[model samples]
Every structure is written in structure tokens, then in C-alpha cells.
Target: MRNSYRIALAGNPNTGKSTLFNALTGLRQHTGNWAGKTIALAEGTVEHKGKTFQLIDLPGTYSLFSNSIDEEVARNYIVFEKPDVTLVVLDATSLERNFNLALQVLEMTTNVIVCINLIDIAEKQGIKINERILTKRLGVPVIKLSARNKIGFPLLLDTIDRLVTGAIECQPIPTVYQDHIEEEIKKMEPRVSAIIGDRLSARWVSLRLLDGDEKLLQEITKRLGEGRE
Candidate 1:
């Protein structure tokens, strides 16, 4: 049997996410509708250092809040399917706006790597990114990449390998809310944890519940029902 691990690629649209996917997968990619959903999801395989990494390219969304079907699909996969590693790609020139999704993923999973893509364009635009500072702030690995030129490709793959092999560890920083919201989350977290049973971050789920995410609540109910059956 071949050693294989699943990696999810997530990012906002127009962040060159598909470009990176194409470059990495290189003729080993396919697209199909996500299970029970009309949204299309891309899948491919990459071989690095004797391990097969199955890359699932999730739909591009500005947030995993599930405001749309695309967002719902992406969020469900990350929260439920639980890939070995999630590559959160971002535009190097627009880090602030891109960070919304990144932070959300960090809340949902610790197996994350933030890739600042389009470094070449950012350099031309006189934008500088300090990956070290970003890594420190986000509490996860950060990589500067120019996928079009294959810059940082080797390091990215090596990092993935190290992470999957337990040579490197990721400790993602979860978002902290205000006092009232934090209190509410504190009250609800244990209940959510009891229902999910370590399947997801209870605090994050509690936050979503407080935000009035009825869809997520329904998903949790549906999943639990399915489990019982």
C-alpha cells in the first residue's frame, strides 16, 4: 500500500490558488462535484519524498462562515473531513483582507500552513512580507511563495513532509472575541464539545452558534443523526 495523506487547499478567489494547484498537481488533477452538493471540488496527487499527498482544492471563499454553498462546502470539509494539512493561500499584496479566512481556518484546525502567494508581484508592487513575523503571530508555519515561478515550491513541499511526518508541529492561534462574546462562548463550549465529541473545536462552534449560524447547527444535527443511524 502507498503512503498517502490528504491536504486541503483553501483561499479567497483570485489569489492564484488554482495556479498553485495546477503547478503542483501538473496533469494529475480532476474536478468533480462535492458529495451531495453541486459545488465542484478539485482533487489531485503530488509525490514528494516517497509519500503521496492527495490535494483537495476547496472552493474559493472569502469566509468559512457558510454564507453560500461554496463556503458551506469548504467549511464542512475542513471541519468534518479533517484533512491532514490545510494550505491557506493568500494574496501577498492583500494580506489583511485575506486573513479573515486564514484566521477562521486556524480556529477550526491546527494542521494549517499559510502561504503568501504572488510574492513576485508583491515585490514589484514594493510590498514586503515577513514570514517569520507572520508565523510568530499566527502560531503556524508561514511561507512566501510565487507559484507561477515555482519559487518556494521545494520549501513548501518539505514543510508539508515535515508536518505530516511529525518532524514539525503546528500550533494555530484561535481568534479571541470580546468579553461578552467570550463569556457566551465559554457557556456554550462545553455543550458543543459534548455533542461533537472532539470532532471539531467546540469554542469555534460555539462562536458560530452565537453568530446565529443555523446552517451549521443543522449540519451538526444531520451529522449526529447520520452517526446514530
Candidate 2:
């Protein structure tokens, strides 16, 4: 039997996300609209080192807060589908903006890899990023690459292989909110964990609740209720 893994590629628009997807999957990609939504979904398959990986390229979005249909589609797949690894590709020139989505994904799941794309542009613009510092800060493996040039793909694939095979472990540190929000999260986490168990991060669920994300709350409630009965 062939070993297989599922990966989700997420990022903001114009981060070379589609470029990386095309590079990795070549002719093995398929596209379709998301279920009941106008946003498009692309999925492809790639085999590396004798392992088959199914990569789902989510629609580009600024964040996973579901402010838009694209955001909702991306967030739903990462949270509900729970792919083996979620790769957040970021534009190196705009790390501040792109980092927001990366942090949000970290809160949802620990199995994450931060891909810093557009390094060549950053270099031309005289912008420097310390991958070591980023990896240390995020508590996840950080890879710097020019996806357009297909640089660092081997390392990316190796990292994915290790993560999927449990050869490397990831334990992302959750982002700390303000004091009041932290207190609320502490109070709500246990209850959220009781409902969702380990399938989703309790802290993230609590954060969503505090933010009054009615749609996500409804979906979680419905899924938990159905699971119970």
C-alpha cells in the first residue's frame, strides 16, 4: 500500500501560492468551486520520496476570520478537514500583514509550516528576514524560498515528509490576547474542549467565541451536537 498524506496550502493573495501549487503538482491538479460557495478550490497530488501527498490549495484570503467567502472556505478546510499539514505561504516583503494569518492558523493547529515566499524580491528590495528567528518565535519550522524559482522545494518536501511521518513534531505556541480576553479564554477553554475534544484547539475556539463569530460557533455547535447523537 502507498503511504499518503493530506496538506492544505493557505496564504494571502499574490504570495505565489498558486505558483508553488503548480510547481509541486505539475499536471496533477484539478479545480472546482467550493461547495455552495463561489470561491474556487484547487487540489493536486504529488509524489515525493515514495510518499503520495494530496495538496489542497485553498482560495487566497487575508485571514481565516471568515469575513469573506474565500476566508470562510480556507478557514473551514483547515479547521474541519484538519489536513495532516497546513502550509502558510507568506510574502517576505509583507511579512507583517501575512504573519497575521499564520498566527491564526497556529492557534487552530500545531501541524503548520511557514513558507516565506518572494525572498528574491525581498532581497532586491534590501529586506532581510532571519528564518532562524522566525522559526524560534513561531515554534514551527520556517522555510524561506522563492517558490517562483522553485528554490528550497526539496527541503519543503522533506519537512512535509517528516511532519506527516511523525519524524518531526510541531508544538506551536498560541498567541496571547489581552488580559481580559485571556481570562475569558481560560474560562471558556475547558468547556470548548469538552465539546470538541482534541479535534480543534480549545483556545482558538474560545477566541472565536470571544470575537462573536456566530457562523463558526453555529458550525461547531452543529458538528458537536451531531457527534454526540
Candidate 3:
């Protein structure tokens, strides 16, 4: 039986993502640079119900479009590595802006759980988040907690356990684009799916190609070439 699962933690800058990572992994975590890249990543592990989860703290970025090296590393890790679960941390006080990254993550993978951190501060500021509405709208589980106060950690851990054990199912909502853009995606999706071959999200890849993401294209070509060798 598989007792270990890979989980990726991603979010925008200053969303308390690193704090949550440290809280969950404690002294078990380590920081290291990704292969051949100056950018560093933090990794750690947590045990829940006799199962182990290896968590990788990805560099914070606003979007996964790969506009910079940080975005590129985070994007490639999620799209290529295909972690067992992706915990997208969002700031409850600034959820409107944070949704940009969360939505992109849903578009890329269905194995996702949205975490609204810093809820206590948001409440003090008179900001409220209806996680139920978010879950219904996004078609994935939504959780709220204060990573700093260590509140909601139990539910968060249980949620992760259910997701990893297949006790919960995620049906990520698809991102709707303008009609013309959707038409272009439709034209390219099949071909992109063929090329990617279950390794990544074809629709997401097609969108990047349309946007002239040469880096992603180069990486895909390199990977495909390597596969053929």
C-alpha cells in the first residue's frame, strides 16, 4: 500500500503560506534550490493517521503563467510533477485578488484544496468568507483557518487525509474565457493533449502556447524529445 503522498503548497506573496508550512512541518523541513536554478524551495513532511505527506513549499507568485522564474518553477512543479494534492493558500482579507492564482490552479489540476488563511485577522477587520459558497462555485473543498494561531489545523489535516485517501473527490470548475479565445483553445486542445499525453493539462498548455509562452513550449519540446529517446 502507498503510505506516502506528495502535496504542494502554493500561494501569492505574504499570504502566510510560509508560516503555515513551518507550522505543519516544524523542524522536519529543509530549504534547497531547485535543480540548476538559483530559486530556493522549502520541503517538509507531516504525519496524519499513520500516513505521511511530503509537502513542497513552492515560491510565491501571483499567477502560474510563468512570467518570471518563480512563476515558472511553481508552474512546472504543479503541471509536471502532478502532486497528489495541491493546497492553495489564500489570504481571507484579500481573497478577491488571491482568487486569480486559485482559479489558475483549478484550471490546471483537479487535485486541489483551497485554504483561506488568516481568517481571524480578516474577522477582526470585519471581512468574512463563505467557504461553502466557494466550495460550491469552485467544485472543490474549501477550508478557513488562522495559520498563526494554529486554529483549524485539525480540520485542515483531516481534509488533506480524506483527499489523499480518495475519501473526497474534486471536480475543479473550468475557467471560462472569451468566445474567440475559447475557439482558439478548442482548435489546439486536441493536439496539445496528444503531445502532453496525460503528463500535464492540455487545455492549460494550449492556452500558454496561444499566449506565446516560449519557455513552456521549449520545456515541452525538451520533455517530449527526452521521452522519445
Candidate 4:
């Protein structure tokens, strides 16, 4: 029997996330609205290296911190669903703006692959990115490609396979917060760990608590039961 993995594609609007999903899955795709929500959901299957990967294209949003429905859907899915890998597509031409979402996703999940799409356009506009340095800094694989043109698909597949199969170990470097905020996180981490334990990242849970994200707190309580907290 062939193994299967679930992958989520996340990024800001106009980042070519859907384009990459289509390239990877071709005609093997389906779309529908998320349960109890108006946001559309796209999922597709791709077979590579004797394994099948189910890719979910999440709604595009500027930042997961926003309270918009799209942001909530994207954030909640990654935090609760816990996909095998979260592939974050970035617009290479506007990396600075696009990176905001990338960094936010990294905070929520360590299983991430930064896909810098639109490399062809970036090059045409005299923009360049150092993937190696980025990978080292983020402590996750960074792939550059023109998704529309199908460049770098092979490498992307290999990286995804390696990550999902545990052939490659990923140790994401946590983002540094303000000193006071870090202190609060350190204090709350133990309690958060006791609540969610290994089901979610303790530090991230602590941060959410500090941010007073009522919706996320409510979701956590609902999912894990009110007594868990």
C-alpha cells in the first residue's frame, strides 16, 4: 500500500498559491466551500515517489493575526488540523510584503516549506533572493520557482517527500519577541504545555494567550474541552 500525507498551501492574496497547487496536482483537483463558512476550499491529490500527497489550498490572507474570516480560516486550520506540511507560497517580486504571512505561519507550525513563487518575474525585475541563507535563518527548506512555468517542481516534490517521510529533519527557529513579551511567554508556557501538551506548540499557545485572542481561545476550549485549560 502507498503512504499518504496531507499538505496545506498558505499565502497572501496574489502570491500564486493556487497556481502552484494546480501545477502540482494538475487535473486531480476539487473545490468546495468550507463547512459553516463561505470561504472556498480547494484540495488535490498528487502521486510522487510511490506516495500520495493531498494538498489543500487555504484562503489567502494578509496576516493570520487579523480577525477577518479568511485569516481565521487559515490560522485555525493550520493550528487545529495540523497538516503534515504547510507550504507557504510567497510572491518573489514583493518578498518583503509577502514575508509577513510566511513569518506568521512559521510561528504557528514548524512543519513548513517556504515556496518563493514568481522567480521568473523577480529576475526580470532585477530582484534576487538567497535561498540558502533564508533556509538557514528560518531552519526550514526554501524553494524558489516560477509556479506558472513549473520550474523547480521536481525539487519541491523531493523536499516535500523528504519532510513528510522524516528523511529530513526540520528545526524551525522561533521568532524573537520583545523582552517583556518573552518573559510573559516563559511564565505561561508551562501552563499552556499542561493544557495542549504536544498537540500544539506550547510557546505559540502561550503567545496567543498573551495576545488575548478570544476566538482562538474559544476554539481551543471547544476542541479540547473547557477543562483542558
Candidate 5:
């Protein structure tokens, strides 16, 4: 486990997720598609904190539902591969919407860090964000970034260090949905917990399944079955 850490970068479209990946990996990145899917996967390795870290740049998508190849690819990697850490990038200039994806991913695993990018643009637009408040609310490290300018890259690396080394902790800001949804989650949560164990968040898995995220459900079922006798 100490030899290498795999980190997945997930986020919505045009959120500067790829730009950040490029910054982190430089010319080291290589691309390939999912085994049977058309969706492309970009991966690179970098030495950090005396350990080799494998960074996967997952396709940007609005949600985890299997509505498109990109979403399915991203969802499958996180749910099945179970990477060591997932850094969900959010566009600082449009966080109100981009953040929905961050919250969604947090539900999947506690190993999530919210990378808020484009802060330079947000400030120029007169938008002010309290990083401490956001971090507190998300229960995850929130690092500000301007990928183009290479600002906050060190902070991002530090946050990743905390996550991969198990120094930082993430607790999903609890969500309470309508009665029917809550009831459904109640039914699925225990079953998922009994299957996947606690590394994968049961509530998040339930929500993904409820929303017809086949990529996740299929991956979970496959992994769980393998663990059985």
C-alpha cells in the first residue's frame, strides 16, 4: 500500500479538471480507453512525499449516472478500482453548480478532496469565497487553485499528502432527501454496508444506485460477489 497511491480526479465539464491534471503530471501523462468502453483515460505517475502516486484524469461529467460513456467510465473507475484518493475539482467561478458533483463524490468515499479551481477568475469577477468555511462545511480539504497560473499547486499537493497518508479526514455533510428517497436509502444502506465494508460510503452507493448509476451498481455487485465464498 505504501509503494504507490492511485488518485482519481473527477469533476464536471470545463471545470479545469484536465488543466489541473496536466499541471500535476506535466508531460508524463499517457492516454488509453476503458477496457471495453470508448471513454478515454489519462494517467501519469509523479513522485510525491517519497512515494510514487498514480494520477488518473477521469473524463469530466455532470453526474455519475450511466447516461454517457464518460460518466460510466469515471463511475466505474471509482466504484470498482477503488482508488486510494479521489480529488473532485470544482470551478470556483461556478461553484454553486459544480459543487453538486463534489458532494456527490464525497458520498462515494471519505477519501475525497475538493480542489476549487479558477479562483483567480472568481476574484476578478468580485466573488469572494471563504476557504476555511468551505472546508469546514465539506469536511474535506478545500484547496484554491488557478491551474493556468500554477497558483496553489503546493497547497493541493499538501492536501493530497494528507489524504493519501490518512492524515486528513472527510465526512460527508449529511444530506436529507424527501421521504421516499430517504426511505429507499434506508433499505439499501445496510445491504451495501454489509457488502462493500466501510471504505465505500453506503449512503453514497445507495444514492448512486437509486439514480440508475449502473456503472457503480455493477461494479459493487461484482466486487462483493468476488469477496464471497
Candidate 6:
């Protein structure tokens, strides 16, 4: 495996995210608990076109607001130690809720790909997803697949290769909020920007702060101090 590329998998629980990760790397998946957190994350490395890429499977959750420990695990990886690219998996049958988490991760990291999983089930349920429309709307590539069948893995890998290597540029889709929140973001952002710089959007960080995630807030504050030191 080449040393240049790294990726992370994130999504809501039962989105077939784990199955996809297993299919991608097979026996290569490594498991361990995150420091100070009992929850575990599985990581693996895969080679595509002579390039080696590391992939981490994060605990599935509906949001990154840290409502649960699993959600915190996903949030931490995207925010502080943002991976090179994050695959946001969405269940074809439950896209609206899945899109929520995807949108949150986009704020933390620029490189994102939406994996629309379980197309088989969706089709049976008469749910038709316009992948092209989803891709255009999110400003990221959308890969439709049924992990169990190993369908679309090659195309997904090819797209990911382009994303991590900079052959394609991913600009996160803009998120809209109430006018008052937008005003607050504009005001609080500069304060956070001094630390995260161009790597993270301060407006998004401010939203996380407002959500009252004390642990994450402390982590950000610590990083800010470390940056200055």
C-alpha cells in the first residue's frame, strides 16, 4: 500500500457502512479503542492503482452533535484530526437523516463522498435516487452500491482515488440556518479561525460550540493553546 492517501467512513447506524468497509479492505481491517474512550474504531489500508490508502471506520450515528458516545467518535475524527477524505454513507431508504450527518462532516472536512448504500432494498421499496442530482447538490461524488453484492466497489475506489490525490476538488455544500444563527456564526468565527486556519471553517466550529459539546469544546480549546505554544 502507498503512504499518500487516507480516508474515513462515517454514517448513521445500520447504513451498511460496516459491510462496505469490510468489503473494501477485507482482512486488512485493524481494530482498537480510541484513547480515553472505550468505543472502538476499525481501520484498514487498501491499494488502488499503486496508491496505498488508509481507511478508518467510525461508529455510526445520526448526527455529530455528540448526543451519544458513538456520535462523538465520528465527530472527533472529522473535526480535530480531519482525514484526507471521508466517505459519508447514506442508506438509500433513509436519505434525509443520513444527509444530516453528511452535511455536518462536510463543514469539518472539504473532501467528502456520499455512498448511497443498499440500492437493492431501495429499488424493491420503489425508492429511486437520482445519484447525479445528489452529487450535484452536495458538490461531491455519490456512489451507489450494494456492499453485499460487491457491486460498484471498483467505481467507488476509482472515484476515491481521484478525490484523495487531488485529481478532483470537493467544495462542501453550503448549509443554511436561521438569520440569527448566521449572524452569530459571522461574529464567533474569527475567534476560532485564529486556531484552525484554512483547514477548518470557523463558522462550523462555532455551531458545534453552541451545541454545548463540552468535551469537544475542551478539545478544540486545547488545540488552540497547543497551536499558540
Separate clash counts for every candidate:
0, 0, 0, 0, 0, 1
Residues 116-151 of candidate 5 have per-residue lDDT tens digits of 899999999999989899878878788888988999
Candidate 4 residues 1-229, lDDT tens each?
4399999999999999999999999999999999999999999999999999999999999998648999989998999899999999999999999988888889899889999999999999999899999999999999999999999999999999999888897888889989999999999999999988798889988887888888888888898984456
* N/CA/C clash count, model 2: 0
Report how far residue 22 has shifted in candidate 4, in Å.
Answer: 1.2
Query: Model 2 lDDT vs. the true structure?
Result: 0.91
Worst 10 residues of 1 by lDDT: 171-180
Which stretches of model 5 miss by more than 4 angstroms? 1-3, 195-199, 212-216, 226-229
Where is the poorest 10-residue window by lDDT in model 2?
218-227
Q: Per-residue lDDT for 116 in model 1?
A: 97
lDDT for each candidate structure: 0.93, 0.91, 0.93, 0.92, 0.83, 0.85
Q: Candidate 6 clash total?
A: 1
Candidate 2 lDDT over residue span 61-167, tens digit each: 88899588788889989998889999999999999999989999999888999999999999999999999888888899999999889998999999999998889
Worst 10 residues of 3 by lDDT: 193-202
TM for candidate 2 is: 0.96
In terms of TM-score, which candidate is stronger, 1 or 2?
1
Q: Give the worst 10-residue stretch by lDDT in candidate 4.
A: 220-229
> How many clashing residue pairs, candidate 3?
0
Query: TM-score, each model?
Result: 0.97, 0.96, 0.97, 0.96, 0.90, 0.93
Model 4 regions lying over 4 Å from their true place: 226-229
